[model samples]
Target chain A: MAFVVGMLIKTAAVPIVVAVVVTWLLHRLERLKPHAATLGVACGFIAGWFFQEFSVWFPVRYLDWFPAAALILALLPRVSPITAAWLLVPAFPKMVPPRLWAVGLLTVSTYGLAWFLNKATDKIQQRVIVGVFMATGTACSLVLLQSFSLKFAQIAGLLTASLTAALLSANKPYGNAKGLPFLFIGLMCNLMFIGYANTSSDVPTWCFALPLVAPLVLLWNPGSKKLQAVRYALVVTILMVAVIPALLVHPPWEAEH
Target chain B: MSRNILIICAMALLLTGCNSEEATNPSPDAGDNTTPETSSGSGFAVTSENTKVLFVGTKKSGDSQAGGFKEVSGTIGVDGDKITSVNVVIQVDSLFSDQDKLTGHLKNEDFFSVKEFPELTFASSKVEGSGEVTITGELNMHGQTGEISFPATVSVTDGNVKLDAKFKVDRTKFGMNYTGQPDNPINAEVDIEILVNAE
Candidate 1:
C-alpha cells in the first residue's frame, strides 16, 4: 500500500513539475494557452521515448538521428498540422534517456549553449572558450569525487586551470573537440547539483528562487509587490519540505533486469 | 599502429575459425573406443525459417536474465530419434538484451566470459528416450567442460523441424562462481530453454 502510494505520488509529481516549467516559459509568450504549452511538453517527452526505444534492435545505439529529423520535418512550412501531431509521438520517445541519458543530455546541452552563445555574440571563438570551461569542470568534479576535498581542489585546480588557460591563450581553435569538455563539465555539474538537492534536508528558500528568480530578473524585472510576495511565499513553502535530490535513489531492481 | 591492426585481424580470423567445425570426431585420447556414427540417422535436425536462438534463464544469483545470439548458426542432429550432435556458434559479442548494463556485464568475465570462451557447443555421447528425449552431452562453457543431461521435445511440424528443450545446470560445475552464501545458496540454478530450426 505504501509502495503504491509512493509510486502514485511520483507519477503525479513528474507531470506537475513539467507543467510548472512549461507554464513559466509560456507566460512570456503572449496569446499562448496553458493547455497548448502542456501538450507541447507532453509531445516532446513522448517523442524522446519513441526515438530512445528505436535504439533497441537498431544496431547503432549512439547515433540518434531522430531529433534532427523531427526538427527538420517540423520546419517544413507546407507540412500538415495533423502530420506534425502524429510525428510528435515518435519524437517524444527520442527525448527520454536510455542508460546514458544523463551523459547525452549534458553533452547536447553544452553544445547547444555554445552554439547559442556563438550566435548571440557573433564570435565563433566563444565555442572553444565555453568548451574548455566545461571539460575542465567535469574533470575537476570527477577528481573531487575520487579524493578528499582539499586534495581534489588542489589537483583539479592545478591541472584543469592550466589546461583551460592554455586553451584560452591559443585564442580558441575552431576544433570540434572544444565543445566536448564543456559537455563533460555540464554533466558533472548537473549530477552534483541533483545529489546536493536530494541530500540537503533543509533547503533554504533561496534555492527555489535561483531557477525562477534569476530568469525573471534578467528578462522582465517586474515591479509588482504582490507578485514578489507570492514568489517569496511559494519559495518558502517549497523550502519548508526537504527537496530530496530525486535522481539520487534508483529502484532497487532494474525493470528489465 | 600496424601491430594493433595485425592483432585485431588475427583475433577476427581466430573468432571466424572458432565458428568452423573443429573435428568430425575429436577425442581427448588417440586410442578411444567411442565411434560416433554420422551416417546412421543419429542426429536431431532442427529447421526454422528464421534461424534466431533465444535464451531465458535465471542467473546464478537469481537475477531474471534473458539474452540471445543475434548470429546463432547451429545444426542439431538425432540418431534413432535421439539428439547426438549440437553444434552452436553463438557470437560472443552478439549476445544482446534490452537491459544495457546487464548485457555488458554478461559479456564481461563474471558471466559468459565471452573473451575467453566465445562459443557453446554440446555434443552428446549418448541419447535415450523416445518422444520425450534425454540427452547426456558434454556442455562446454567458459572453456570449462562438463557433462550435462537434459530433456527435450523433438518433433517435425509442417515439413519443418522444431526443437524445444529445458534443463538446469549448476554454473559452479563449470567454474562460474560470482556470488552467493554458503548457508543459503545464492548461486542460481541456471535454466536454459533452447529452440532451434535447421536451415
Candidate 2:
C-alpha cells in the first residue's frame, strides 16, 4: 500500500502539481509565454527525481534520461537559436541496446519528428496534437507494463500526465505550447526505445512498432470539433481490436495467489 | 523564486548523483571477470549440471517463494589438500521463480534488472580452515560491491573439489530496494544456497 502510494505521489501527484505550477507561472509572466509549451517537459524532469533510477546514473544508465534530455534540449530554443539544441543530441544513445550505431538513428528520428511535428502542427488543432500524443502514450504504457520494464511504463505515464497538465494549464490556446512537439517526441521515443530494446516478453516486434505509427491516425482529420473524437476512437480501436489480441498471444506473467 | 530554483536543482541532482565514476569505458567484462587463478596449480571447472544456486524470499504474509539460477559457471582452484581460490558467476537472466509472472517481475528493475547488470559475481580473496572452512571475498551485484564472509564445507580430493554453503544475503545491501507491497512486505534478508561440484 505504501509503495503504491509513494509511486502515485512521485509519478502522478508530484508531476501533476509541478506541471500545473510551471504552466501557471509561465502563463502569468507575459514575457515567458513562448516558454510555456516546454512546461510539461520541465515537469517531467522534476518527476524523474522522485522516481529514483534502477541503477545509479552510470553512463550506461541513460535509459532513464529521456525526461531530463527533453527539457534541457528544449530550454534555449524558446529564447535563442534552435541550432543550439543540436549540441545536446550526442548525449543520448551511447548505446540504447543491441546495436551501437543503429540506435543513433533512433536519436536522429526523435529530433527529426520534433522538427516535423512542430512545423506541421503549428496551425493544426490543439485537440489533435495533444490527443495524438496522449493516445500513443496510453498504448506505450500499456504495452510496456505488460511486456517490457514497469519503470519504462511508469516513465511513459508521467510523460503523458505532465504534458497534459502543462498544455491544458496554459491560458493561451495553440500558441502557448512552444517546443511542445520536441519534448513530446523525445520523451515518447525514450520509453518506447527502452521498451523495444530490453523487453523480455513474447510481444512481437511489429506490435512494439504500433505506437510509433499511432500519430498517423491524425492524418485523417475531419476538420471539425465534433469529429475530433474520431482520432481517439480510431487509436483505441486499433490498439484494442488489433494490439490487445496480439499482445494476448503471449500472456504477461501473473502474480501467484 | 529562488526556492523554486533550489527545488529544481535538487531534483536534477538526484537523477545524476555526485561521485559517479568517470565514463571510464571499462571493459564489458570488467568487475571480477576472471576464473580462479591458474598460478596455484590446476583449476577445477565447476560441473554446470552438478552446481546449484538457489534463493528463497519470504513475504510478510508467510508465503515464502523460491527461485534459482539456471546458468552458474565457476572454477575452484586447489593447492594440495586446501582450496586456494573460488570464482562464481551467476547469470541474472537465468533466474526463475515459482511462478512465471514472478519470474518476469524478478527480472525487472524492482528486482535483478537483468538487462542492466546481467551477472552477479563472487571471487574469493581468502580461504581458511579445512573441514569447517570460511571464505571471504567481494560480492558484486547491481553495480555495487560489498565484501562478505561466509562459512562453508569443502573437500579437495585428488584433482576434484566439492563445496557447499548456505548463507543469507541482505538484498538491500546490493541496492535491491523494493520492499514489496506494504501489506505483504518481503523480508530484506534472502536465503542463498550454493553447491558446487568440480571434477
Candidate 3:
C-alpha cells in the first residue's frame, strides 16, 4: 500500500503537476516561450532528484543527478544544448567495458537528431506534430525503462507529462530540447542510457531504437490539420504496436523492480 | 600538454566497453570470497538452515512488512572462543517479502536498487566486550557505508559458535527516504534481526 502510494506520487501526481505548472509559467514570459519545450528536461530533473540519491559516488549511480546537470546545460543562455550530450560521459555503465567509440557515436548521433528534429519543426504546426511525437517517445521510454530502472522510467514519465501539457497549453512547447535544436535528442539520451542500464530484459535491442524514427513522420508534409493528425496517429500507433505490446506480455515477476 | 590530455582520453576510450550481461548475475565483489581470518582462520561457515537475517519495516499508520534475503554468505571470525571479526555480504536481488509486488518494489530504486549496487556488506571496525557484546561495524547498504553499533549475545563451544542480535537502522541515513504518502508514511526506523550459528 505504501509502495503504491509512493509510486503514484513520485511517477504520476508530482510529475503532471510540476510539468503543467512549469509549462504555464514558461508560457507567461514571451522571451522564455521559445524555450518552453525544455520543460521535459526540467521535469526529468525533478523526477531524477526524487527517485535517486545525489550523494552517491559510483559512476552510473550518479545518473539521478544527470537530468539536473543536463537541464542546467540546456537552460544556460551561454552554452549550447548539445553540451548536455556530455552526460553520456558520466553515464558510462560500469557493468561493461568502457566503449569510448560507442559513447562518441551516441553523442554525435544525438546532436544530429537534434538538428534534424529542429529542421523538421521549423513551422508552428510542424512543431506540434514533433511535440506529440516527442511525447509518444517519452511514453514508450517510460515503459521500456521500467523493465530495468525506475529512476529513468520516472524521468521519462515526467518528460511525457510535461510534453503533453506543454503541447496543450502552449501550442508547441516541445519546441526544443534542454538547450539544443530538438527535444527528442534529450529523450534519446535517456533511452540510450536505459538501454545501457538494461541487462535483464528480454526485449530486443532494435525495439529500443524504434522511436528515433520521429523525423520519418516529417517526411510526409501533410496539406491539412486533419491529415497531419491522421499521420501522427498512424506513426505513434505503429511505434506503440512495435514496442509496448510485446514488452507488456511479460509477467510482472520478470521485470526488474 | 593538450596533446597528452587527448592521448589520455583516447586511452580511456580504449579501456571501457558498453554494458552487457554482467548485471544479470549478481555476485560479491570480484575475488571477494572473504573469510574472516585469525591466527588459525577460525571463520566457521554456516549453512542457510542455521542462519537467519530478517527485517521488519513499518508504515506511519502502523502497518508492517517483513522480508529476508534468500542468499546470504558470510563468515564469523573466532579466535579461541573470542569473537574477533564479522563480515557479511547480502545479494540485494535475493530480497523476498510477504507480498510479491513489494519484493519487486523493494528491489527497485525506492529501496534496494539491486541493479546498480548489487551487494550489501558489513565489516567489523570494532568488537568490544564478551558475553553480552557490543558489535560496532561499517554497515554498507545502497552504496552508503555508515558506522553502526548494535548489541548481541555471543556463545562458543569446541567446534560450534552461536551469535544473535537485534537492532534498528534509520533507512534515511542509508539514503532510503521514501515517505509513502501524506496519510500513510513509511517509518524511518527498520527492525533488523540476525542469528548466526557456525559448526
Report RMSD (Å) for each prediction in the order shown: 20.3, 7.2, 6.4
TM-score for each of the candidates: 0.35, 0.81, 0.73
* Top TM-score prediction, candidate number: 2
> Clashes in model 2: which pairs?
A1-B182, A37-A177
Off by over 4 Å in 2: A1-10, A51-60, A76-99, A170-173, A224-229, A241-257, B1-34, B38-42
**What order do you get sorting by DockQ, best first?**
2, 3, 1
How many backbone clashes does every candidate have? 37, 2, 10
Residue-level lDDT of model 3, residues A1-257, one tens digit each, is: 24533653555555556666666777677787766556544664455346433334333444544555545545652222333434433322253424344445555566555656555555545346546555555646545543444444555555554445445554442343324334445545545554544434455555555566654566576789899888778677767754674356444435221
Q: Score the docking of each candidate (DockQ).
A: 0.04, 0.18, 0.13
In DockQ terms, which candidate is top? 2
Of models 1 and 2, which has the larger DockQ? 2
Per-residue alpha-carbon lDDT of candidate 2 for residues A120-227, written as tens digits (9 for 90 to 100):
565666656776777777777777766635576667777777766644753433557777766777656655656655656766766666676666566555777678
| Overall lDDT per candidate, in order of appearance | 0.40, 0.65, 0.60
Regions of candidate 1 where Cα sits further than 4 Å from its true position: A1-257, B1-37, B42-53, B57-63, B79-84, B157-159, B180-186
Clashing pairs in 3: A37-A173, A74-A178, A74-A179, A81-A179, A97-B16, A97-B17, A98-B16, A98-B17, A99-B16, A99-B17
Off by over 4 Å in 3: A1-61, A72-102, A123-127, A148-150, A164-181, A195-209, A212-215, A224-230, A246-257, B1-28, B39-41, B46-50, B98-100
Rank the candidate models, highest lDDT first: 2, 3, 1
How far in Å is the alpha carbon of A173 misplaced in model 2? 5.1
